[model samples]
Target: MSDKRVPSMTPPNKAYPREELEEMMQKWLAANVEAEKAGDWPTYLGPMYTEDAVYSWNIGPNEDFVAEGRSEICDIALGFQMHGFEEWEYPYHDIIIDEKRGTVIGFWKQLAPYRRKDGSRFEIAGIGGSWFEYAGNYQWHWQRDFFDFGNAKDCFFQLAGAGALEPVVKKKIHQQAKGALLPGHRKLREEPSRWEKARNAMAMVKIAMTGR
Candidate 1:
């Protein structure tokens, strides 16, 4: 496709139309969503984001979790494109448009295989809430905090997808075992001790299975 600028730069359309803006934002979302689901982010990162883009996994590993610029951002996700994704998630994205500032509020989630080749799946999940700031040229300028997954499978997906989770995620299952008995909040029960142990074991297995 042409890298040519749009007509709005001049005056044929005057200002950026709301519909056009939403569509453009949708395309960015589409790019991210597709890349995330298909497990290839290079396409989205290249054609869909700006050079100075920011990536924040909310406080990161240390105070060093935040990355500025496209290169830095890629450093965070490149490994995932290599060793992760396929063995992992159900990446979900919910977008909200802010026409005034030209931004999108993206709610994302990573979930365990709801179905697998061996016929195994989780009955619970969690969702994350994050936001993306646009650079006005159909690219992202910044990405900020979103909530943690509320269920086991979701966080597990995040841990696997990130490829850097030193502490594996089996908390969701434990939490479910302990909490959530109501209708709207009904979830699988996961006790503290059980989950911690199972998760630790899982962590060891994951580490041994994949040297990633």
Candidate 2:
């Protein structure tokens, strides 16, 4: 749990007028509500990204998921990754839009489809959210998701041990263990982690400004 590895950081994106960003976000949010209700992510969310969008999220300490371009984003990130989660609901708790930076953050909950034997809803522990960089035309060019890997593991184990997991999900867990890496997943060292670059930039800026 003490691994020092950090996920890559997205570069600064082009900014838009605050009014434009707000209007776009409002429309996008309304569409998202309907999409969530329908549970058709690939169909609904795929078009929300630019053709050359990049989407990424950390799987754990040793692996990361990165999908480049909209096709990959839709097929791998949205399609394969979401295969067994058709019935799950991710209700947004809050949304923050940084119009100056052309970014949007949405905090949500990952709720399972089924209830526990004790009649309580099964949900992943810890917070879940997505950070997105907006493109000018109502599309996102970059996206990253954050969630607690440990909590996700514990929840999955509890459901699986109790035989409450969806059949597809159980199969997927086995496949992930034994099968070859999916299209977008890579070993942690495979890609150059962007945190180092960000750190170097910060140091250079500080040195220039303060003569340190």
Candidate 3:
């Protein structure tokens, strides 16, 4: 299998002081939280990334989403997905810092405002973490995320089943599920049946846990 790991863009010997790195991370997190709250994608969040930064995530085995450079990372990677998800929240619950490597991993959760029949808000509760490579001067040169796609797909299906998803949002999800490529993304290897089976299993688990 080909390596799915993202290569570091910054030099290995170049390191920032632990205190400075912590402060920078705190500032970036605060700015991102504020920008997200105000729905200001081009503001604080965009500035935290370096000019040649890379943003990426894995969809499944051998399938990935990648955005290289600031323009693609900002406009397509971060911007396009926010549509129809105005009420969605991504709150980082934990952070692990590697001072020597100049990397930080942030664990976050994706939450939707739509409530289920059991009065619980629809949420894809799974492991979601972003590994950020610090570029100094309070910016990151690389950011890659890992998350459970099966759980995410199940949440979306539940939303669609309840007629809670907007038409445009539903269409976008359908297109992606059918292997349509987004801007700055590489061609995806089709595995619709595998994804569907995973989603089905996740949905059954969710139903069992929620009793809904």
Candidate 4:
């Protein structure tokens, strides 16, 4: 397989000390929460990346979403996903630090405050993680995320079908389904294997939940 890795444009002169790295991460996480809450994406989130940072994620085995440079990362990759999720909480459940490699892996969940049929808040039940390559100066040179698209689709469908989605969000979803690419993002085409994998996983979860 061809190497998918992209070298960092602004490689750090030296790896950050473990304690300093940990402290920086803590501050970053806290700032992220506040940013999300305040809807201050440009001020709070944009500064976390290097000017030449690359952000990417796999849709499955074949398709990938990639955004090169901090502008694309903020305006496209991050902006597209958070379009209507202003109220959603993305709390990291775990973080693995690699001081030697200047990398960190964070496992987080997307949670919505909307009540489900069972009176519980809605949360996508699946794995969600991000890998960050930290450049010096408290900025990231690269980031990639992985998650179960099946669960995300299912949750959104449930909300939309039930008329629980905000009107703006519903409109956005419809637009996306109708082939409107997010700003600074390329055309997104799905692979058969990716669709099948997502569908199968969702089906298994539904069967387990309802014993069907």
Strongest candidate by TM-score? 3
Which candidate gets the maximum lDDT versus the true structure?
2
| Model 2: CA > 4 A from native | 1-8, 190-212
Could you give candidate 4's per-residue lDDT for residues 61-139 as a string of tens digits? 5446777898877887767656677788889999998887788889999888688778988888899988888887888
Q: Write the per-residue lDDT of candidate 2 for residues 88-202, one digit (tens) a residue.
A: 8888888888887898898989999878889998898898999989888888888899899999999998888777887777777887889457667777664345997798899
Compose the digit string of candidate 1's lDDT tens values, residues 47-128.
5557876555432111223455677566553333233344454344566766666656766555444454466553234456
Please tell me which model should have the higher lDDT, number 2 or number 4.
2
TM-score of model 2 (CA atoms): 0.80
Give the least accurate 10-residue stretch of model 3, judged by summed lDDT. Answer: 1-10
In candidate 3, which residue ranges exceed 4 Å CA deviation?
Answer: 1-13, 188-212
C-alpha lDDT values of all predictions: 0.51, 0.81, 0.80, 0.77
Worst 10 residues of 4 by lDDT: 1-10
- Report clash pairs, candidate 2: none
Ranking of models by lDDT: 2, 3, 4, 1
Clashing pairs in 3: none
Cα misplacement distance, residue 178 of candidate 2 (Å) = 2.4
Q: TM-score of each candidate?
A: 0.52, 0.80, 0.81, 0.77
State candidate 1's TM-score: 0.52
